[model samples]
Target chain A: MDQALDLSGNKMTDLGNGHAVIEYGSPWGRPIARWVPSWGEEKREVIERMRKHLVQRFGEDRGLRMAENSRNMIIFPNLVINDIMAITIRTFQPEAADRMTVNAWALGSRDEDPDLRKLRLFNFLEFLGPGGFATPDDQEALENCQRGYRNAREAAWNDISKGMPRVGPPKNDDEEQMRCFWREWRRRMSAAA
Target chain B: MNADAHLARAATASGQCTRAQVEEFLYEEAALLDEWRVEDWFAMFAEGATYEVPPTGDGDELDPAKSLFYIADDYVRLRERVARLLKKDAHSEYPRSRLRHIVSNVRITGFAAGIADVTCNFITYRTKRGVVDTYYGQHFYRIDCSVSPWKIKSKRSVLDMDQLYAGKLTIII
Candidate 1:
């Protein structure tokens, strides 16, 4: 707890350059399943679907080869301020033999693009601020931002669409939302670039 | 006049709790959540305490009005949520996701004997299907130590991942 406090303080003190460093330690670390025995017909179906879709969006080897480095970076593009200094992940061969722990350290100058930072901060204050206390008003603003974010996310995915492997298309609203978000995000980034 | 009287009384009442005690209460709650003791976790709340998880977009701190999930003003609603988790029928809890909650930034924004307002920053990691997902949220808890050794009067978990990939919030955030 004290360590977390100290880290937070450091983040606040350093402001833009600071990284919100967090460490979760537990002797109880263990896999939810001792073995993903489900990697059979049913599991294979899901995996194939995931692989095809990922390939279509990201490209080639699907996720078998490049998943480790790209998973976090792809999911959260903003987190990478500078080139990722390092990412270490511990995994077991059988998939569920033991718990896997992933640790990443990023180093970058605090020059968070001003427009990006402004957008981020504005989004934050809008939701967490006292103005959001009004339930209806809060809900409306929240929905609008979500709509924008979904568009941005699909745009992002579309940026890497060329290299993306082909998997099954999104089956539900959540996956569709992500796809749309990345697609729009890519469009905006290209326009700016 | 009624609201004014309530506010005055609340302000006066909140002044009594020591900062350390408030911190301790929060830590205990975190411990319970980390342990995955759902029933015990529910007991931490006051009788009418509400547990809310508001969805914010882009994980941005500025805009909150467009939250995806909003549980407004109901303790029983939270109870129903917990009940669903406890049942075997809840697919979201099926494999029973494992969670590690890291809570920080505990600050006492206000306090009173039977009422207190507090804020905490938390990051939770949930693992399932050989995949790990992360979530960040600020917990807004209203407590009443005077009522019964610090029961939560209300709790709002405002998650940055409002467009959650999962089907439902089976585990307490």
Candidate 2:
């Protein structure tokens, strides 16, 4: 399920000053229901209801566009706003050389229908939060990378060269976003020194 | 006494499930989890059951629809959760952490219309990769006693800690 949203096809635009946005365009311009065709009838029904609600509330064109597009925006240092199946605003703070605290919140539209709101919250829980299916794996991957860095004395350099030779915009899976963040981080550290 | 004896005694007396029956059920559920019998544990829930865990410090009455929860799985999502965790690719649990679930302070707070509202305090210890983390919480349950083997209609585990120790609730609490 996680791999279906192929980040390799996403388009990343550098927003300058160590910020960037990745636009993950939906396949066939369909809503989430179409993304996972194997979902059971119950799930498909809920998604359809929510999609119809969106169309009714915002009219056809805007609603369809809203359902089809997802964006991840990084704010220079330690904040990310992911407007995906649900809106997630996340930030992290480093406490020590090897420790950091992360916080996340789900954002929803005001006065949303009770049923639709439940669906939104469920979507958020499925992917964004610490207990979610996706984020915990992300945490594990990050922590494993941190552990590997214990050998930094011998492996001093980390690679972020993905898509460095791309002709135009960078893909989401590329290291361009990290490159942006590191560039700004180096600038700040150099200035402080 | 065996499970059937307890249930028979409880049923003959008041036609209602007693605290003993509830405790037995909870203990069995905990055992299934500790033994990593997730599929068996999932079977204890009703078809449309809900499993929720509100953020630490949030009130028990906080509506998951309006507020954020560590987990607020509906029937479909709950099934998906079980399926995901049982897979070899669920990296956080791929090597499956060692877990011990301790359930205490069982109480039958309310009962009506074949439904019983139950509560209990819990402390689950998870050891993984040589690190141990403790998750202590109070669980609020709504069990449907109308069935032979009471099914869980809703289970809400509310943490008492001020914050998650490592900001990760990667284990089922």
Candidate 3:
């Protein structure tokens, strides 16, 4: 569901940095620039926190558990980032050079919203494209980076499988909920009419 | 008139549309792209057409040498680009895209010897990931003498907005 704005509403200017605030003053007036001094810094910290929490929640033993046929290898590099959810390294056939697939997620928020617990998660599953797997030396390097995640925190999962096969197109669940509300509102209006 | 004027007049003797007609043709072409009619849009270009998207600077006619995205050599490359855009295999268009294109301020910058240079300003509305991304750019088109059929010999999309707002450059600018 796409968000539609009434073009005839208040005068709006696109600041180009994922933000647009409503202006009631003079359309020609130079409004104060919307500033988020702690935006980038806060995001960085939250990412770190999320990483720590995940490790503690999913211990090494349970985190790496998989189905017998999964043929998956998990590398928790010492320099692991919370922003990166999980990276699965797999091989297609015995002779094929090891192929790497990175499963990373970005946590962000909309403007004027500062709910860390309510952060939005965007997932990206990319086949790192033919090279750069965890070599024996690389495997040794990641062992140093596996710290435990902080446990007992709220968490939610969103599947960001846009543009990927068999994974239905990406959708904004919130937007769909909003659409349902509007549909219900219209139905009620017609009933009252 | 000098030798140049005589050559120009001789060239103009062949079939060619007026500036307004050329603009109308381009405008219709833009409409096809905006509506996501991929095959119909491809039919607009001439055989062996050259499409170029130069990495422009503050200056005009950005040097081809610095072009970020260039297809100066062949039409097959353009076809490949359009093919990838339409293909479901391209990860960039997983959800496909909803776009609205606005082309305006078209001007015939030059006309002589049956070769004309055309310019226009445009704005694009690219929507995906629940966001609407805006892009502004100027288009440069050079019609060749061999373009008796009034086909576009060359097309250069010189964008004013450099930041790629969308996830990828899957659609034509």
- Model 1 lDDT tens row, A1-193: 1232221111111112222221222121111111123223443344355455555676543232222121211222233221111122222122232322222222212654443333223222222222212222333344345455566645643222331353543222123333444555667788899
Each prediction's TM-score against the native? 0.41, 0.84, 0.43
Please tell me how candidate 1 rates in CAPRI terms: incorrect
Task: Estimate the overall C-alpha local distance difference test score of candidate 3.
Answer: 0.46
Range of the 10 consecutive residues with the lowest summed lDDT in candidate 3 chain A: A26-35
lDDT of 2 at A175: 77
Q: Candidate 1 on B58-77: residue-level lDDT in tens?
A: 33232222232333335655
CA-lDDT, candidates in order: 0.48, 0.81, 0.46
Kindly give the stretch of ten consecutive residues in candidate 3 chain B with the minimal lDDT sum. Answer: B64-73
DockQ of predicted candidate 2: 0.63
Off by more than 4 A, model 2? A1-9, A27-66, B1-15
Question: TM-score of predicted model 3?
Answer: 0.43
Candidate 3 local Cα displacement, residue A19, angstroms: 35
Task: Provide the clash count, candidate 3.
Answer: 8
Give stretches of model 1 more than 4 Å off. Answer: A1-193, B1-14, B58-73, B112-114, B161-168
